[model samples]
Target: MNLPVMRVLLAEDDPHDAELTLERLAIAGLDVEGVIVNNEADFIKALDSGTFDLVLSDFHMPGFPGSEALRIARSHPSALPFIFVSGVLGEEHAVDMLKEGATDYVLKQRLDRLPIVVQRALDEARERRSRHDAERRLRESETYFGQLIDALRDYSVATLSLDGTIESWNRASEWLFGYPAEEVIGRPGDMFNLPPEPGQPTERPLVERLAEISTGTSLAEERWLMRKNGATFYASVVTTAIFGNGGAVRGFSRIVRDMTDTRVAADLLQMAKEQAEAANRAKDRFLAVLSHELRTPLGPIYAAAQALDLRQDLPPECRRSIELIKRNVEVEARLIDDLLDISKIVNDKLSLRLEPTDLVAILNGIAEIFREEAAARHIELRYTPLPYPVIVQADPARLQQIIWNLLKNAIKFTPRAGEIGITMYQPMPGKIAVDVSDTGIGIPPQALKRIFDAFDQGEEESAQARGGLGLGLAIASSLAQRHGGTLSVRSEGQGKGTTFTLTLDDPAGGDVQAPAPVETPASPSTHRPATILLVEDNGDTAEAMQFLLAEYGYEVDIAENVAAACACIDAKRYDVLVSDMGLPDGDGIDVLRHYAPAADQIAVALTGYGMESDVRRCLGAGFAIHLTKPLDIDHLIDVLQRDNRS
Candidate 1:
């Protein structure tokens, strides 16, 4: 084995004794590097000049004693080992040297034992240093842990003993549990839990919890906990086991957070959601009832106008008056449709029937519908058809509705003698663009941003004069996006004319500048004259429809209610059944059930309840077709004239 090197400071007056002491130490397995100092000044200089692990000296020097050397060595910051070697020494002097902090004393006659004494002193000094460092680290760890516990103000932190006794509590624990550390320390950890309700089982015992946590796992719970004042609150508690250096369970740490407010907030939000759903249901019912009441009267009025328009002996002024009444009725019907469409969009219930349709055709048809009205207001309505068809995947009716709203808005806002232009072209390959520009009261710069927002009509005075619910642009914009397209507007300033641009993706297969297709009118039906049953509740609607059906070469019978319709069905056999959905006693579905037509007979439902769900319900109840009011006279005539020969 190799012996460790030791630096020794030798304080001796005789050089021979110093040499002999180092020789004895080296023989006894000590590696000694010695510096001999004969005087006190040399000894003190040697000690100050370098580092040494041990100090050796003679008992009596010429001018200095070993007692003085021991005193100087003990004054250093470290616990350096000091030993005495002397040739002549008394017991009294030895006692004095030992009391002065010498590690050991050996005489020259017993110099063989010097190495053992020196080795013992060095071992004891090293052990002292190890213990000192360990104690310092423990102090720092405790201080840091205390600061961390105090800094956590939101959670209640408590330490428990192996048996579940509260050992320490932080400041947050006092605030949350309403107890001071002095009162809670040494108490059972379960004291924070609320007592079991009457006749209920008690909580788990401390021994049970300790056994589970001894396996080095954590436990979590949420329940009511009682404070010091006996007031109870909900909280979430988590208990984790803390371990020692030897991997044994030392104790546990418990954390608690209040959860009463969070629970109450969740409940309140659920209640609010339920209330909103109820309000939405009520609004849908109100709109359905309102639609029926408003549209019921318009059916007969429109039928009467159609009947007069078919007259060949009316004066030109009378004919014009009839036309005005018919136009206003159609406008009213469109307003109702707008209200229902917005509701459907809001509820995410709006659906489309998409097909490859001609965009140019839709634009031309809508522009022609408004041309006469625009001219009456002294506005020039301009539209130049493309030679070829611009085709896109779209719902034909909904696509027409979008363009109709845009052109109608232009006519309403444009001043007399102002020009309203409908321009169509392809801005790029695979893209079709339509620009509806009007020299009208342009939108303000600030209002332009939110012009498409529902019910946000720019320039309130103009909107008031030209009355509308202001849902047109919002519905149009939403529909444009749904069709994989965009509707955008740009205007320089007020009165500078606004241009609305509608752009859509165009699929292949339509020629550029292709001529519009000519529509062929349906020829009069060549089938045998059919018998009809008309079920209507309103007197005017029942009578007008009866007269129109008779004029169209059909045997028509009228029934005012469910009982009358059943009576008419029992008395006579009819080939066609035309019934309004809303009757006095029951709905039209009841009449169809009573009629029980054969395979060749047809059942047609006419009503003002035009919601998508209503339409589905009518068709599902076995109606051949469902139509909404104010009735389309030509479509009804066409339905009555069809060949039901199957």
Candidate 2:
């Protein structure tokens, strides 16, 4: 069997004590090899040879002491176990040496305990080295992790204890939340001014909230947090419960971002979209107005044609045809006027002529226009005048248009024999409300959300069900807004009926008189024979207009395109210049620029582009009138007659 080996370096001036300790170690069944040194030099030489497991020394020697020998042994590559075996030193001195890093010491008189003391010292030195190594490794790991957290730039990292106290704060956390590690660490999470309520503890503190979350009874919430300077901002806050090894609640982690700018930008974009949708609705309204006006003239024209075909008695048929033609021509004239009104409104060029107007008179006039239609449908349409002649500061014609559109909508939507009520009342001292209530198919809840949107009919399944290009309400609403009032609708839902209320500003100052109408010449037929220049790219339309003008007894000249029209204008002076907006060489605006006609001469634009903006462009370019095709023959005739007189 192999015995345990013990190599020892002995520092002593006396050889007898050293030999005695080695003999005792051997007697204890330790295989011992010993080197004897009398001073520090020999002791260090023996330690440097790397042949000893422990150093056993006398406390005092001739020139050196056991303390010196111990120091030398400790300075070696492997710190040898150091024990002071001394006879001259007292217990106090020996303890002093041990405290100075002497592993242990045994008195020379107690030779029996020397071997046990040496063995215990060796075991302790091994343990102390192992503990020192472990501590160094732990410090290195902590430094590495700290550097890793500091390197992160994007996200704020922090740790909290189970009690909601911050235990660790990272650099990113300091930059994002405006709190440094020194100020934030060891404080409760509420110090950062996060929600349940900023700068205040939650009703149930974060710890309890986390506990609730762990129990599957609570969800995290996002909210606005106030900054250190008390500026409120949005954040996407996410709270998650941290878990211990056994899956118990530890704490929570929260992440936040400022969303104020993002939300504002999103709102701005939404507003732009709504504006675009409003513009589209306006375009739809224009289409509906055009369709209505065009259909009116066609009704009489169709009737006249039918009458002429059915009658065999030539004299009566001729009279009926004459009457029919005259009526159709008048209807066509009104259609052209309404189209021009719609165009002006669309282009934003339709300026309101504001003046003091009797509100009752305007309502009465609109009611009279709709009375025949209401009578035909057997619907009761009546206006209840206010207690007094409630005068308002407004444009009479525009206000009349607003009321007429509303009444027409009521008459159109009301079922046969349904009641229509119109009432004007003073809701307040400075406010007047006009309520038009109808017993008809009411708006559905879903449709009401977008009822004022142009061209947005609640349903499109039936032609009658789809109301007038949805423009009447939109235009009426716009008009009300321009007049510093509001138009709003309320309904009980489908099949329940609906009411539209128009609230206007009451006249503050005293009322003024309405403007008198301008009367024209009695006989428009005896107008002067005027020279006319017509420019058109379409041969068929050009020929028809030319023939029509000649029949009306006017001198007519035609150009196929803008270039020819400009050349013609340069060569002659005409009473009126009629040109299509689009030509082969250029647009009508270009021709107008070339002609540069005197202000008194009339310039009329004829084109297919009927958008409000298109008409405005023509007027802005000095056109007296703008007309969209297919042309109204009688309106053109009337315009020619008027221009001749001018």
Candidate 3:
């Protein structure tokens, strides 16, 4: 079969030989396109300007010598098939020309042999062209695949020789390891792993795993690997062995993905949880210490004010001012108590003392306390009692606190001359509801949902002068729920007023009865003078207690710390011992521990530390009563007088 056409350059000077060569090339199974040239100028010009499959030349030319033509063709950029077609040349000359980069020589006299020689020469040239194209395509494909691997940003890809020496690295590998291809190629692959961390086993290193995979499969594992920047991170690496067709190991490929971010995120979440818990603990501790610090000094101030109120020598105005001082001091103490209660409620630590409580009586008692404050603000406070009293099984003190917080919140938001009313009734058959309504700036519709949220004022500072810490309503709501009740609010949007209703469980199924009187002042009672040991840490509180006890006809010996109280107890006997729970040196419980006072002698606990746990521990330590500060001196005197009578 005839091959495709071949383009030939003929440099023979003789016209006869050039025509014969062209004719023979055409007769061959392949087609031929020939350019004939003989002189050095035309031959060199043709060779330089034209593309040919073969070059045919004579031994000598008119101007361009055949040797020089051969030299020109050899020196050209591309390879070309050069053949001699001279019939006059000696065997030695022809052999020498063949040695000078010639394909073959054909004699003009043996012209019949021309077709086979041309066909053979053209066939070899076609093979050489095919070989060059294949090699170029192979080089391009290798470059494209290399770049594809290098473009992977999340994985580090590397190529290693069979002996575990790095042969090539993609750009991603360079980025992850901090080593460029120029610096790392031909080095051992172990350069990626520096000194391993402690407890890193030496039994199966990366090199060993790579060696195992050299048999033709892939090995995947997770390990702690190092980087050129001296950082260590966990990575998932896959080592695959590349094999040749002969089934022999050629080289290896490694792909690695870093696993640091997910691990660090989990660790950070755990750390954040720990920090939040620690902050909660710190807040609780601060509240406990704050309660002690706030109430300790107020004990002396309130007692002093109460003692001053008892003076018959004072004018009516002075006595009235003293009563205001005492009333406001009680308000300050209640504010401190609310702060502690809210903290306890938030931390899930608050406990209530549930009993059979007359809801109306509890409401009426706390209502009287706020009347004077309301009158001062020119906001009339009124309590509309039910026709009959409604009683519930609930915490009386906590119930009073809930009612008090509502009144306080009302007074805080109510403008001057605004009226506040507390209406008590049975809203349902099994429920008793106390609705405290105020004529004030009403709540917005959006804010009504979160008005009872802790620390949520829900009102602008201009609308209401800020007084409390915004936790009062939150505590009220919490206390109501604790007593099997619900506290909710209703507002007619912005300009209208708001009403807060407290609904509690009515455990007593029978009909309501006439409400009992709330409280009456202790009638000026006379008590015998008694020897008392008064243990107080604050000097002001100690001095004030002594004066108040003297007024109540008792000889009081004051002690400032646990050590002083212990000394006082060891030195003398007393009728009653008043000990503050928290002392500078040790707990006031220590004094009770040192000297076991007889049951007949009153062991009354006077303490600024007032939580349920604190009261329980004080009672467990043999104190007859646990009285919180700013020690209600009137209540204390009543207890003392009642105990003396008993």
Taking all chains together, the TM-score of candidate 1 against the true structure is 0.77
Q: Each candidate: how many clashes?
A: 4, 0, 1
Please report the TM-score between candidate 2 and the true structure.
0.46
Q: Which consecutive 10 residues in model 2 have the weakest lDDT in total? A: 295-304
Best by lDDT: 1
TM-score of each candidate?
0.77, 0.46, 0.58
Greater TM-score among 1 and 3 belongs to: 1
Candidate 3 C-alpha RMSD relative to the actual structure: 12.8
Candidate 1 stretches greater than 4 Å from native: 1-135, 160-165, 186-225, 230-236, 241-251, 259-272, 307-315, 509-536, 546-607, 610-626, 635-646
lDDT by residue (1-646, candidate 3, tens digit) is 7566788888887888788788876665457888988777887788779888788888777677777888888888767887777778789988888888888887888877877777788779889889989999989998888788878988999888877888988888888888889999989877766575599765455567677777777888776788887898878888899988898888998888888886678779989989988998787778767888888878888888878877879899898888878878887888778888887888788988887777776776788778988998999998865566677888888888888889888888888989999987677787778889999888999999999888788866733567567788999999999988899999998768889999887776547666677766556546557899998878888898899889878899998888988898889988898998878889878888876878678888987766667778999999989998898888988888788766
- Residue pairs with backbone overlap in model 3: 40-64
Error of 2 at 637 (Å): 6.2
Report the error of model 1 at residue 285, Å: 3.2
Segments of candidate 2 deviating more than 4 angstroms: 1-152, 155-365, 378-380, 383-401, 419-426, 442-450, 459-468, 490-498, 508-527, 539-554, 630-646
lDDT of 2 by residue, 199-315 (tens): 765566666666666753435455666665666766565665677788777776655556677777977999998998788677656654565346434433533444344445668
Off by over 4 Å in 3: 1-266, 463-466, 513-529, 611-617, 620-622, 641-646
The sequence of per-residue lDDT tens digits that candidate 1 reaches over residues 45-155 is 888887899898887887787777888888966558888888887888888878878788899999999989988988888888888888999899889988898778878
